[model samples]
Target chain A: MRTARKPLTAAGLLWGVVILTAVLACSILAGLSTGGGEGGLRELLFPAAGDGDGTRQILLQVRLPRVLLAALIGGALTVAGAVFQALLRNPLADPFVLGVSGGASIGSVLAVLAGIGGTGAGMAFGLDGRMLFAFLGALGALILIEKIATVDGSMSVYTLLLTGAIFNAFSGALIYFLQSIASLEQLHDIVFSLMGHVPSTGFGTVAVLAIGILAAVLYLFLQARDYNAMTLGEEGATQLGVDVERVKRRTFVLGSLLTGLAVSVAGLVGFIGLVVPHMLRLVLGPDHRMLIPCSFLGGASFLVLADLLARTVILPGELPVGVITALVGGPFFLYLLRTRRTGHEFR
Target chain B: MRPALILLAILSAACSNNLQEQKPDPVSPKDGLRLVVVSPSAAEMLAELGMLERIVGIGDFVSRPPGLNRLPRVGPYNAPNIEKVLDLRADILVTVRSEAARASNARLRDLGVEVLELDTSHWEGTRQALRTLGDRLDLGESAGEILASLDEAMTTIRQRAEGSPSPKVLFVVGRDPLYVAGPGSHIDAMIQTAGGTNIAADSDSPYQLVSLETMLQRLPEVIIDTSDNGPDALRGRLPGPWDTWDFLPAVRENRVFWIDPDLLVIPGIRLPAMTERMGRLIHPEIFGDPVEADFEPSPEPGPTETTIEDSP
Candidate 1:
């Protein structure tokens, strides 16, 4: 019985990793197909010779960066969502659910309208001021909501969820007010920016984003056992030797960082965070050990596929990937809510 | 003789007092009177007339004309703060005509402010608006000079492209569903004046989507995409849908152009330069000789060049 169980467990882990790898590989292949040229997987994996050819230049410069960025954002958001859901013991938790995304959006909109991103003596580092402001805004929202939701050194699931909802509404109103004051051209930028279209950032920037996401995910995964115990109330987890407060604080900070970094790169890509975690939870069960790792893979694959559809559905013109995720995630979420047999309420 | 001279002096003084007591015309204010101006074009015109110092309040969006940005903003063109205008105790309020600002204009008039509405929707409208503004501000001679110079520049372009064949042009204002300016739009008028036929001119709406099927059928000679604010918009970034129709004359001949929408679409005193640019884009061969340069054309071979193989 022990020998049989050992192989079965090993097979399960291997199969899960294989499935994730397949999804990532497929998405990369599909992304390359949308480039619309003679080049295929060879050109996708390896850069073409420097012949100064226009087609190769477009493929190498534009589509590659966009696809890579989408994958990074998708992976980061999903991992963040998985971590939050585990920490809060709520399946419905997402990066945006805590108001971080909304606050970041407002900050970015303000920066764009004020024309803060351009290089000059006015702003240091020549970074898009909107992106920096968005980071700060996310941090601000996280701290404020954490303070309100935490009572007696313990985070309440109910308060955290409620605060997030109210803050989301407030941020939406703030964005609209900023829009009213924006110029016609600035309005276009703000609208597109909010719709979650990942523009082509350089490979260097993508590398930086990848490193940030990986570090956050690794940190969260290290405390996976603590998250598993927290699923059984904070008092119970503490009795079982889990430092519930420390885990909650660390998770919130790390998760918010991942969220802010993703938003700064890819705007607000909704549904990936909410949908990916739940979908992974259904397969992997409530264990964060498996859930967190699988969520990253699932989210990355889902966004890559969604982005492929976004680019190809209205071919030549692109639909914002956020719209596609909402269309797909909304019904799936409702289905999950409807088919619940257990008495466990989602926070 | 002394009594007669004293009586004449008293009569002359009475006549001068009567002239001072008479109220100025409400519609047209007297020249050299202090007034606050709103609207960037109006502010620019004021500066052009050497009357910037007279402007006490300017619109929020008026950043151009050098010194106007420093002035107190009276709000945007659509909604100028009437309270500020009244508080400044200005003579008149000038504004541009748009559907959104109609109510604001009515309110301004109701508040006893002399409101002059200018329709700066097209080149002709822009010229007429400038002239009307000049008439209102009592800068008639300067307005006449500016209008005459504008007319001369437009006439020069018209004469240059008089007998040349008009190219079929597609002017895209926005992407996604292919929004283009139709008849009754200033862009359409500019395209016509520049010796090109606007393919979207027959659409019902002023700014409407010209179906992709219709676009493919029309096969325009020149495709001018104003979606981007700069020159590189038409190059490799022509989006995806258009790539499928590489056989179209515009694509095959590398006739696609990208120009700043503000310069071409915005109705202002820059119409002359706008028309000249449009003419060059539509028929560069007519204005100047075509030069052989390496252009990164679309990779997909056009339908005209593609061959179908028979299957056994």
Candidate 2:
């Protein structure tokens, strides 16, 4: 048992480092290659006065920050997904299964329609009150769903997922009603916000997100052994001396918090959270010790690459980052669903 | 003297009675046609020409020209409520852009309603539509006068700005996918007429998606975003996506201005006023001389000495 554990732990750590390196390299390369062919390797390395030119500035300032933000959000969301799935012992669960994204969207639309985002103080913080309200809404939804899904002093994954779907539908109906009353300008703002364009926020905001996500990941990782045991059914894990309830409560709060933060910042960047954790699981096996950290790095790299393609696919015009993710991830998800029928029930 | 006063009083009474009996009602056209205008601007123009009473129905979106509220709404411009139009027994249906509402227009025509399709998406098109409408409505003289004044305004702006250096302007219509007005759009034409060059005017399409990279390369002197109503849609608000490039003149001088899209984009009688505003925005030095007409002019007296307001 000791010999088996040592290799698994080393392999997990190695893969984690490898993915982090790959993501960093891709982000830098993508930052340089965006804009046009003008920002080649020579321009990236030297950046001469003439060579640095207008195109280089676009690649660095506009595209670079956008790519970095995508990476941070993607990583954060996927890690949250892995944690939620392990906590519930359900492979079908995704980051948005808690209805955080839906709540955030409603709050964003309200902020935009109210015209609060246009105030001077609203603009100074880089993220307008729209984003703040979205975060608060996300937190509210997480708490509401958690309370409803819990019965007889314990949480049920089945109840949680069902309630989440219902809450999402309710939020969608509310958004449509808001759209009907919104002016044309407000409609534009709401549509774009929900469609998930990562507007270039300040580095400070990105750093805050990165720190928040990383802290959550680290906390979850420390509970990795408990997660492994919880996979064997809650009663069985409790019989094995694991404090199942304490683990469940902590994971739910931390996991949902990370998910809410990501959704608030990036809108609903679909598929990454749902698919990345599963894909990492296939490679690293069912161990949360290996799957959780590796999923974060892999997801970040995937999104950074996706965002690069979104910007450069049509020069002088960009496709929304959400479009890029769904276009690629949708087909892959279908393939996974079709080929893999393990029927390994998750909770 | 008493006999003269009694004779004068008897004559005044007879004259006053005759005047009350005549009433001086303005005659309707030879056809006595009842029209329904589906476009808001058309409704406003028709109302301005003393033809509001002739309009038996209007589109639901027609909010301007306050008296129109009492008129029956016939759905939106693109999809007119056919039942309402038919029920009102409208003889003629006025709409903008025949192609925009082809099915609705065809349906109206099929129902024996005369559909007058007007293309008022540009200045010249709007002028032509006005003249055609006037000819059809038998208000040719008023239409001719309105067209003449519009011409006078355009000529004044052209002469003032013809020799001046035109500023390179970027007219952003939307931000997140970054849409700009290209050649053939009314906004593009207005920019050209107002002695400013639209950077996106060279695009093949009427409206094209421009990249932030291209915008930075162009480095326009003025950035005017007619994205929406407020300052958030303006050029300098958070600089969200464009903050990275400090070399942009618009960024450096904070020359980004936001105008109401309705005022700048909608093609109507407001084009002259729109161009004048653009001229002032682009080259304030030359066309800064403000021309203020009483937008609410005193009511003119009709031929028989009745106020135009009282004609109906």
Candidate 3:
């Protein structure tokens, strides 16, 4: 409805992408420039006269990978949230609203309970058992929710939403049961994993997560026009020569893939998914074509900066990035809701 | 710290089994005046004072002083069941100082129970706690003897550690989020007395969740990791996870140790023994190499008679 009301021009879309990309670049620069340690962009720009391996290691080995991971997770979660909102035709829809994050959390909690964490439990290409199990949990939850929601040969939006809500509640209860039995040290790991902090990972893991998230985002981007058409209603989309059911199924799968990749690596970094898409939609309108790409870049910038604040706000001790995101995003979103004109396009 | 609070809430909530039991009429104290010791460290102190038979109930986390096993568990240390404590007819309830359980302890006191909140988290607090508990229980002579032995043992340890190099040490309490022992903690005091500079001495709190990058930058020479609690978690002088950070001096020199947290975390009469163990781990040349038992999870306190004199 928003796209139909306001025509999106090619030039306007280009300008939006360029501006968001510039913002993302700035955010990444800031993220790479500062950290909890001495190694930073200064070391990279002007090498000391003496040995600088430690500084380089801090920059490259610690901060660089963390920045990249945050960017990727942010982008993936935002894109997934935007797509889910379009498919569900609900402004409140988020990547985690469909129980995928809860599934990832259960897997993560179970892994910690079994003592399968730390950088030492390396399984493949810097992927530990915890991350692997989280991804599998997300995938399993997707399959289970899909099966429960599908009726005959079709999936109903209302049924899908309800199934996801119930599944998430169940997952939460199960995780609590698991936590009850966990040792104090294991309990610490479980709580941190759920609270969501971007860990300093190897480049191999970042590269792998990047490829997976980008491919899913690309697939969803291909269906942007279909999403725009569906905003009119499912029947209207079908009347406009769109394969409504096929597009819906594909969007569900691709969006869920993005959410899974993010939750598996970074735990449950909240608010970015729920807040960024709406913020971008208010600025760029609900044209999925522009909204998808801009949301990715804007969300990437948002989280990179939030993570920077999370690490630096208390000097040597770092807060969970999720805390920063929720603290900033929740109030901003509430303010936007309170001040914005009623029945706005994004709302 | 926030996570620890969440964990405390979870543990408190999980101790719901006792809540389901019938709340029988609150029984008045019997002639014997039984004691319910909710703090594991305090229970260990009571056992050391030869008052093990006096404890009628224990908090959930208390595992030491095996004689108390038959006693009914009230609940976790932070959220003991008041009904259960009353049912056991405990005239005196001894618990550790906790901000979270302040209201519960207050309510217990209102209900006519003599609640003794002890601070056994540091050496001085433990000494004071022994004195207070001894005065209350009329075992002041035994408490004095225990304190004397502890001071004598600690003085010997400090004398042995006088000239030894103070290697930079990292006392890891939890690994995934990198929780460390910082200033004001018993572990921090032990690290200092045993001739090692705590890497987290500059941290703002006693126990802090710190950045891994900052920890690496500090370059600790000796790492005492009591973080892993898995049944098959690494033990002894081995770099299980620290090996990944090959650049760390502790990893390079093979000085990364995986120990049981219970051995050093609980502060009580074992401060001297725990400090001696720390001395062995920190300066083996003078104190002798840590024996196999040093790395194991000995939640049970050693024999009371020889606790001060025993050495690896």
Misplaced by over 4 Å in model 3 are: A1-15, A45-53, A96-100, A111-122, A132-174, A183-185, A336-347, B1-31, B298-301, B304-312
lDDT of 2 by residue, A1-347 (tens): 11233346675678666866676677657655655334554655667777324656666666566667888788877887787778766665665655767877777777777776422225543556665667667667767887899899777776887888899899989999997687644555666668655555567667777777789889998888898888888887899899987997787667666766666666777777778888777656777777777777777877877777776676656667778878766777677557544424542
Candidates sorted on TM-score, descending: 3, 2, 1
Best by lDDT: 3
Better of 1 and 2 by lDDT: 2
Worst 10 residues of 3 chain A by lDDT: A338-347
Cα lDDT computed for each candidate against the true fold: 0.66, 0.67, 0.77
Worst 10 residues of 3 chain B by lDDT: B16-25
| Residue pairs that clash (backbone atoms under 3 angstroms), model 3 | none
Candidate 1 residue A300 C-alpha distance from true site, Å: 1.7
Tens digit of lDDT per residue, candidate 3, span A145-205?
A: 8789878866676677678889989998998888777765566667667767887778998
Candidate DockQ scores, in order? 0.04, 0.14, 0.32
Candidate 2 CAPRI category: incorrect
Please give, for residues B125-207, the per-residue lDDT of candidate 2 as tens digits: 67877887787778889999988988898888878889889888988766654667777666777888889998877665556
lDDT score, candidate 3: 0.77
